[model samples]
Every structure is written in C-alpha cells, then in structure tokens.
Target chain A: MAASDAEAPGMRPWILMSPALGAVVLLLAIPICFILVYSFWLRSAVGSEQVGFHLDNWVEVLTDRFYRDILLQTLRIAAISALLCILLGYVPAYFIARSTTRHKTVLILLLMLPFWISYIIRTMSWINILGVSGALNVFLLWTGAISEPLQILYNEGTVILGLVHFLLPFMILNIYVSLDGIDPNLVDAARSLGATGWQAFLQITLPLSLPGLAAGSLLCFVLGAGTYITPMVLGGPRDAMFANLVFEAIITQLDWPLGSALSLALLVILGSVVMLYTRFAGIGQLAKSFR
Target chain B: MDETTRYQRLLERFRNGDLERRTFLTLLGAASLGAGLTGGPLKGLQRQALAATPESVRFDGWGGVVSEAFRKYAFDPYTKNTGITVIDGTFASGDEYLNRVKAGQEGEYNIFHASGVFDYARYVNLGYDVVLNEDNIPNLQYVMTALMEPFRGVTGGKLSAAPYDYGTTGLAYNTEKISKEEMEQKGARILIDPEYKGKIGGSGDWRTRIWYGALATDQDPNDIKDMDAVWDAIRAHRDLALKYWGSGAELMSLLAEGEIYVTEGWSGRIAALQQQGHPIGYYDAPNGYAWQECLMVLKGSPLEACEELLNFMLEPDVAIAVAEGQNYPPSLDPTKVDLGEKIPELPAFDPTGKLAGLTFASPAYWNGNEAEWSKTFGRVQKGY
Candidate 1:
C-alpha cells in the first residue's frame, strides 16, 4: 500500500501536467520557432518576401539610427507607463485589501468594471471626452474655463493616459490578491512587539506584497511595450510604437521577414526583462500572488 | 444421362453466340436512364446549396457620409435584389485600406471602392482586380469620356473598373473665419500670402500639399515635382500653416473648432458639413485640383453576378441616387437628375470651365519618393 501511494503521487503530477505541456509546445513554442526561422529570410525589392537565408534584415535593424531611436523611445514610454500604473494602483489595492468583505467585493468589481466593455470602445471613449469639440471641451468652454480649446486628444500624454486606464485594473487586482494572502496575525504580532504602524508596514506588509508588485509591473510593461491600437488612435505619426512599425512592415510593406526580425527583437527584449525580474524576484511567488 | 447432356449443350451454345454484346447494350441503356433521372435533381441541389450559403459583398474604402450612402444605396440594393449580404468595412484612410489589400486579403473582399490615386499599377500587377465587360453594363455609355478612358486597362481592350463618381480635391474653409473679400482678392494665391500667416490648415496628403504650394506660388504643379521646390515652398509658408489634417473628417472638425480658417478638403465632405449646419465652404481654385475615386470589382468573383451588379450601379437613376446621397457629383449627364435645391451646384468638367485644369494624384510621385518627401515635410511642417 505504501509503495502504491508513492507511485500514485508521481503519476498524478504527470497526468496533471500533460495537457499544459502539450498546449505550450503546440501554441507557443512552434509559432515562436517559425518566427525565428523567418527572421533570417530576405525582403524583395518590391517589398515582397524572398525565401532565402540572409543577414540583411537584422543588419538593417541594427544599423538604422531611426529604428534604434524608435526602439529606445518605445522602451522609455513603456517604462514610464508601467511606473505610473504601480503608483496609481498601489493605494486602491491597499485600501481594498484592508476593507471589510462587502467593501472588498465591491472594490474588486469596480476594478474589473472597465473589462466588461470592449477595449476598443474604452479607448475610443477618450476621443469623445478629449476631442476639441468633444464633451469635456464643450463643458469647459461653457463654464469659461479657457478662451480656446485645449489641444489634448492626439499626443504622448493622452497615449500614456489611455494605457494607464486600460492596464491599471490588472495591477490593482494582482497587488490586492497578494495583500489578502498576508496573515493578519503577523501584522498584529509585529505591532504587539512595539513596532510602529509605519515600521510594521515597511518591514512586513510591503515586503510581503513585493511579489504582486513585480507581477503587476511585468504585466504592465509587456502590455505597454506591445500596445498598438491606443497609440495609433491617440498618438501622432511621430509617436509610432514598435508594434505599429511591425504591423506597417508586414501588412503595409508586405515585408514579412523584416517584421519577423522586429517581432523577435521585441520578444527577446521582453523575455530578458522577465528573466531579470524572475532572478531577483520569484516568478512563482509573483504568479501565486495573482491567485 | 442423354436428356441432361442435351439441355447443357443447348445452354452453352446460347452463351457463346454474341451474348456478351447483348448484355453490354442492356447495361448502357440502364446507365443512361439513371443519369437522366438524377441530372435535374443534382442541379436543384446545387441551387439550394448556393442559396443556403450567404452571398456577401464587402465594400472597403474611406468611412463617412460617402460610405454610409454606399451602405444605403449600392450595398443594400445589391443585397435585396440578389439575396446577398453586404459587409461595410470602412477604413479611416485610403493608404490603410490599400495596405490591407497588399497584405493578401484581397480575395476576401468581393468589391473595393478605391480612389484612382490610391489604387495603382501595383494592384493590377498583383491580379487584384477584374476586367469589366461594357456589354454587360448598358449604362457604361453614359459615363463621362475622360473618367472612363483612364481605367481602360493596358491593352485598351478591357476596363478594370467602372466609373462610380468623380470629384476634385479642393479647398474648404470657414466663411466666418476668412472673409469673402479676402478670398476674392487672393484667389489661389491666398495659401502663400504672408499677411495671413498661421491661419491655414493643409491636408496631410503629400500630393495636395505640394500642389497647393506650387499653385499658391503661381507655378505649375506638374513642373514642381522636385522635392527641393516642394520643401522650399512649405518652409516659406510654414508660418501660415496651422495644422495638417490626415482626413476630410479631421479637416471638417478643425474647421468647426475654428482652429483653421482655411484648409484643403474634398468638396463633397465640405458640402455634407454645410448641410449639417457647419460653417464650411468649398471652392475650386483657378490652377485646378486633383480628380480621384473609382469603383473596382475584386478578382475571382462570380463574373456574371458582378457584371449584373455593375450594370445596375451605372443605371441613370442609380447613378443620380448615389451622387445625391453621397454628396459627390454624378458622372452621368446632368439632365438625368432633376436639379433640386438639395443638390449643390458642382463645376463642370468642360475644358473651358473656370476649374478646367485638374491634376489627379499619381502613385509614381509618392511610391518612389515617400520616405524623402515625408522627411522633408516632417522637417518643414514641424511634425504636425
């Protein structure tokens, strides 16, 4: 019976893992390999794909100063967006975590409210609010807040605002779950030992919630980096993101090989950042915090 | 023994004497009968199957009142008449829709409403369009000669598209912002007038901006194809430019907001805005504007059905309805429609008319030098 029990545990884990392993290999690994292979192909003169191994695409990306500048700009915008999400999300998440059961449920629902609507609708709603002749401007003009309409619709500031509005719920939910998982007894114990409220929070609660913060930051950063629609709708031509460039390369120019190379470059950058976060911060703990 | 042997001998004689030929004849007769029975039923099944499957036509082009009118008149009528469905895939810009076709989703759409400038030789080379049969369309004879001649394919033996509607890209402005006296005094040269600096809204289209710059300086647009002249003119008038709008909708919006006193826009869209109570007015400049827009059928369609639809679209009443509905001038003769107050007076395409000399957008100019031109424009326009 004891020997059978040991075998059962081993068999159970393998049984549970098979579907997940199969899904990852089929959906993720295979497509990624295809993209990697295509990245080495060449683009034809007329912007069509030529099926041959060449380093020209990679070299172009590496040598072109415009591409490099855009890449750096994308990274900077993504980082700023992620940092903003963290700042805006923390207070609400903390409040929700410390709230009573009913309040906590309401707060969680409020965080998820925007997700009920389509992402496109939510993004476009900003246009209605911020356009020169739109609702907000009309109201402001009626109240005599300003003489002329404010130029707020198409710019970097509005793009970041849209990103934050889209991504804040994920950050808050992740952080809230992490805070909820912390034992109340530990906090009481810390306070009972004469530690001040700030000290208790700094040494205990903050450290405990680090996993959630890391997870939320990773989610926000990757999403912001890969965002296309928000930036396209709200941003000017100069504010084109890396994803938009990839889209234009493949769809507009019909240069699939170059698009593959650019996509892989983005994936590698995002992967390295994730790996770095996992090294110092525990990815498993971060994932668990979301639950 | 004697009786059994006699019976067997008689049967063997019957089997050996051309019996195989007789049996083959009988089988052939039966096969023919079976085919005769099933042929009509098979055709019925095919018709039913086609009926069960929804026949859908997709219209891809710029979105606004024009697209809305197409949805109402062309798409809806086509669907109602043929029991087919219509899909309205409205694009914000022509370049974006062209990109979609380039991405090899051309076959997915049944029809494309493209501007002549946007759909070029590359599309033809890629086999993205179908040749239209003039015989199938009785109304083909009524299309304006100039509008019909250009799309008559490489051999001039076939047409790749039918003339839907034609309009010139011209100037749209707020009459409230820019006085009529000033416009009359300045004429086409108002764009370059140094006194009215920082009060103009130009389109983001490279061709329109370049041509406007050339015409403003009293230079022939066709001769000013060089990037140097284009950039120089833009820089000289940079102080006068308020913004560069990417679409007619954006131009109208800017005009409504009073941010732009005068700007480049389509006459139809400006007319639509005026009808909707916006303070926008349009003018055909003396140096002339660009004529654009065409209706092309997708390749690999049911040719007979598409031909029928094309013919239906070109009917005099249909043409008038489409023109009146979309705010574009009908390509058919003016006598076809009763000139009510609802229809705005549009300039005639006659050579002697005030808006006689018009240039169409050419793909060659942008396709070859977009990067350089965009860079120059970016520098001079200061990134609008």
Candidate 2:
C-alpha cells in the first residue's frame, strides 16, 4: 500500500476516493438537503407537493401546543430512558471489562445474542410478559402476590422499561470498551496509595469511563426520543412519541411539508443535545463514542 | 479430451466450407431450446410466449387474506367471463395510487380500490377518476343509492366511485364484560364512561378518534367542525380509553385477550373475530363513525376491461363469494341477502336504513384540519 501510494501520487487518490464521496453525496447529503427544502414547501388540496417557500410550517410547529407538548414529552422520556440505561448498563460493563479475556468475550457474545431476532419481535415479547393477563400477572397470581391482575403495560413505567431493555446492550458495550482501555496498573497504583477500593474506582476507573457513558447516552437518547414502536406497541394512546407525529404527517396524511418540518425540528433538537454533550465532555470523547 | 478435439477438428473443417449450414443451425437451436425449457422465471416467460396473447389489465389494491378472495372470486371469474387477465398489486391507500400515477405511471394500473373520502376525492379532483355509466355496469342499480353518492366526485350531484363493501367504526364489546342496559342507556357515550376506564381500545389511526370522541360528548359526528370541543372530548375520553389500537390485528389481539371490554372497532374485523369463535359483540351506534371502500378506474386505463371485471363481481354468486370472504356486507340490499344468518351483525348494521346514522367523514373538513387534528391526536396518544 505504501509503494502504491508512492507510485500513484498523481490523481490516483482522488480516483480511488471518488466512489465513497459520490455515495455520501448521493445517499446522505442529497436527501438531507431535500428534507430541508421540503420543510418549506406546501401540500396542495389534491394531495400533491407544491414547490414554494413559506414559514408557515415552522410557525405552526413552534406556536401549536400539540407539537410543543409532544416534543417536550419525547425529550423527557428519552432523557429518563438514557439515564436508566447508564445506571443499569454500568454494572455489567464494569464486571465484564474487569473479567479475564475468555469470560469477557463470552459475556460480550451473550449480550449481542438477542440482536439476531428483530427489534419488533423483542418489543412485542414485552407485551406478553407485561400485559395485564400476560405471563407476569400469571406468575404473580400463582405466587399469591395479589388476586387481581396488575396493569403492567400500556403505561409510562412499561414504556421506560422497554426502552431501557432495548438500549442497555449499546450502553454496556460502549462503557465496556472504555473500561477495557483503562490500564489495570492505574487502579492498582491508586489502591497502593492507601486509597480504598471505592476511591480507586471513583478516581481512576470512573473518570476514564466517562467517554463510553457519554457515547452510550447519546445513542440511547437519540433512539429513545425518536422511537415510535416502543410507544406504539407497549404504551397506550397517551404514550405516542414525536416520531408518531412525523409518521402520521408523511404516511397517513401524505403531508410532506409538515412531515419534513417535524423531522427537521426533531433532528435539530436532538442534534443540539449531542453538541452540548460534546462541549461538556470534550469532542474527542464523543468522537470515540461509536466504536 | 479426444472427443472434444475431434469435434473441434470437424467444426474447423465446417468453418472451412466442409460441414453443412443446416447441421450447425439445428445443433445450436436444439441446445438453446432445450435449456430455455429447463427452469427459472424464464420458463414462466417461455410459457407466456407459448400461450395465446394474454388479454390482461393490472390492478392495484390492498393486500391480505382479502386479496386471496379477489383472486378466487373476482379475478378468476372475470377472466373466465372475459378473456382479460387481471394482474394485481398492493397499495395502502388512494394516496399511493395518486402519487404513483403522478410519477409518470398513469398507465400502469387500470383498476384501483380507494377508501375513505379523502382518498377518493384526490383521484376525482386530479382528473384521474373516470366517470361511470349504468349501461356498462347494469348492476349499479342494485347497489344501495345511499352508498353511491360520492363524497365530492360529482357533476351536479352524481357519484363516481362504484360503491363496494363498507365498514363502520362503532363500539365492539365483550358481552361477558358489558351489559345490554349499558348499550341502551349510554349508546356511544359509553366511550367516556368512567366505569370502563382502562378497558377501552379506541382506534388511533386517523381523525376517526375525534369523531368518536365527539359522539362520547353528545356531539354529532356529521357536523364536527368545532375543533375546540372535539379536542376537549378526545383528550377527556383518552382517560377512559387506556389502549388506542394502531392496527386491526392489535385490536383483535386485545379483544382476544379480554384486556379490553369495549373500544371503537371495525365492522368486518368484528364479524371475522366472531367467526373465529371469539365471544365479542359489535354494536353499531346510530350516530357513530363509518367509511366505505370504493372502486375507481383511472383515466386512460383499461376502462372496458376493468368495467367487465366490475360487472362480473356484481353477479350474485360471485359478489357473495368475494364479500363473504372479506367478512363484510355487500353494498346491495341487505334484506334480500341472508346476511343475518352469516355475519349476525348485519341486521343491526341495517345497511339500507343505517346510512342516516353512519357519518362518512367529510374530506374537506379533514384535509383542512389534518395537521392540527393529527398533532392534537399525537399529543393525546403520548399524553403521559
């Protein structure tokens, strides 16, 4: 590769990279530009897209109480789900990362086993597990915990639970990567300085693992905020998220202008969270979040 | 290797004007023909090539178990009656049909099934829906005139879409949970009754929720222009409706589980559920929501062939087969057909006189308030 690079310094690099550049321009940049342009367009009465420029969609999105409330609710739910993911995901990741090579590999493999099945199937399974007349209630009744079936699903509690379940693996893997990168000698040195076990973890381990935590939080928050299925399947009418609004506008009403506007708003709002995270945590940490 | 060498030598000699042209052409044709008849999608194309020039018209409609009935009752029978082949494609709504046509595919499909007034009006307004005449479709006379009036497809009050099977969004309850007295005392207002809290699964697919919510608050679904009051009732009723079903399958699952006691339900699905041995009861509210699916021929489509197909579907035996397969009531006279013995909910639906009570959603009203109503409903859905 080094010899080839030296041999073909004349326009070969640009030629080699052109396909990937074209793909990015075609797939990502163009569609995003389209969404931006369409957000300002209009829907005709005949269900056709009309090309024009208008601020009405933006105005309506900002002024309307319905969009405002749903957006706010989506943010709240996303934040809670992400926090829960961090709280729950940290323990397993710490243990797994601290494990020997063989055990850590097996644990990581076990964590990814459910990915073979679909997201929809996983979410629907929760319904059977948490439905009033479903497995959990049956188990509780059998154990004589209560005579009546508890309303476990179609509520806020179940929605958050489902989201956490969905997002836990991502959080764990991210944190595990960061934890694995931390030199064991650092924690040992902290302990040798007469620091307690908790002190060693708090000083050497916790500070080092912040990058993974931030990355996982970003993934979980963005996904949970935009999730339509978790709410649609597990939660009730009062559980619809912001994605549901965008979907209804585009699919149900065929109102592209409005749908695009809502999508842009969602992206911008969610994007700001990441920017803020990067600022507070440092851009280098956020960049390493994905891997 | 020796045989191949000899054959190459012979072929080389032939190329040098030693072998006959007839022998070469025959060998080549035989080898290609044998392989062509062997396997794959090409075999199907080969069979088509061998058959009579197939007279066919492409159709776009909804898919599911019902599309199977379309094949058994309509497509096969229509093909038998007239030699036209009916190819099928699936689409979600009239929205897709219009979009596909506008994208330079106007001639792709001849017949389409459009539902809801909003869907039908788009085709009509875009000059895509063809005007119908009773001469070609003599069975039009038998269809209930009440179902014939198009939402907005008219030239001085004449309908466009040939009325097909229709469904109503009324309350479906488990008889084991609800009592007859409740039905009589409250009617559709039961949707908002505190007694049924966390027991109702209101369908949250469309603006239909607002219509039902209006009924719960003693407002007429037909004249529900009052968004303020409708939104209020809808939000209020959301407390009672603990589950807002997104699909017919989801609603059916809830009903089967007995997780819900009552909810806004589809007519066909209720009948189908009953047939499936579910002990569910469908009560058609005299002042509740309803929408009918209709047939339309796109302009510049295979009009005559699609017309023949439509007429073939109207025949009693064929129409009955198709409608029964769908578990839906036909648009024809209900008293004439033995529907009560079949669906059990037919007599109550009262397809003939029931038109007065069933409020077909006004397309203009919905299209105008779509964004506002959709956003409101979105909030209600995720109110937590």
- Give TM per candidate: 0.79, 0.80
The top-ranked prediction according to DockQ is 1
Q: Write the per-residue lDDT of candidate 2 for residues A1-291, one digit (tens) a residue.
A: 988887788778789999999999999889999999999998776567788999888998889888888888899999999999999999999999898776667789999987888988999998788777789999999999999988777887888888998999999989999888888999999889999999999988999899999898889999999998888788877777899788777776677899899999999998898889788888898666445
lDDT of 1 by residue, B269-374 (tens): 7777887898777777776666656667766455556666777667766666667776776666444344344444653233222223566544554445543454
* Structural RMSD, model 1: 10.7
Best by TM-score: 2
Runs in model 1 with CA error above 4 Å? A1-47, A134-145, A251-254, B1-92, B102-107, B117-120, B153-157, B180-225, B229-248, B259-262, B286-289, B335-341, B344-356, B363-384
Task: Supply fnat for every model shown.
Answer: 0.09, 0.52
Candidate RMSDs in Å, in order, are 10.7, 10.2
Share of native C-alpha contacts between chains A and B (below 8 angstroms) recovered by candidate 2? 0.52
